[model samples]
Target: MTDCGCDKAKAELVEYLHNELARDDASDIREHMAGCADCSSEFHVNVVMTETVQRACRETAPEELRVQVLARLRDLQASHG
Candidate 1:
């Protein structure tokens, strides 16, 4: 819904939740977020969603699944080529 100020001049707040700006840029974004309620809420939700997904992956993704997927991918590639 909201563009977070990238190419489209805005993007989802997830873009900023990483806190990945340079020092001056981070400061400017923080200042803007402090005044923007919508952006602030989006940032919080993005953080929570990220953490939730990370935890879910940690609990559910087994090493065996990775191996199986890789093997299938190799087989598929071999057949296609």
Candidate 2:
């Protein structure tokens, strides 16, 4: 199999994906990815997924769901009282 820079990037892949790599290492990874199609594709997927999850987490629960939860809590408190 042809080397696709995967071996070189593997050690720091997780860190790179998570934006935890140091400045120099991250720059090096970017440079390496520019020349490596496979690595670039994988990086793009990782970044997209990470951003998607982060965006999802930032969303508030539906108002109906929040109301339901609060109603359940009130019921439990009333029963105990």
Candidate 3:
């Protein structure tokens, strides 16, 4: 496989992280990161950020807020309908 340089690696990093890249493309990025510290650092930061955001999104809203929002949505729908 060809060695994809820093630009391609950085550009495809998100896709690589999300498992959206094809096998060969992913391999190219992995190979690039193995040798390139900057790209590897950026990938590490992205992984942390992605995990933090995912954890934050997993939190549920307060029950009171959930009920209120649902009620408001129903009211708006009833009015519109």
Backbone Cα, N, C clashes tallied per candidate: 6, 0, 0
lDDT of candidate 1 over 15-52, digit per residue (tens): 45676655565655666667677667766777799999
How does model 3 fare in lDDT? 0.98
Model 3 spans > 4 angstroms off: 63-81
Per-residue accuracy of model 3 over 24-64 as CA lDDT, tens digit each: 99999999999999999999999999999999999999999
Number of the top lDDT candidate: 3
Judge candidate 2 at residue 61 and give its lDDT.
96
Residue pairs clashing, model 2: none
On residues 19-47, what C-alpha lDDT tens digit does candidate 2 reach at each position? 88887778888788888887888878888
Give the winner by TM-score: 1 or 2: 2
Q: What is the C-alpha RMSD of each candidate to the true structure, in Å?
A: 6.2, 4.6, 2.6
RMSD of 3: 2.6
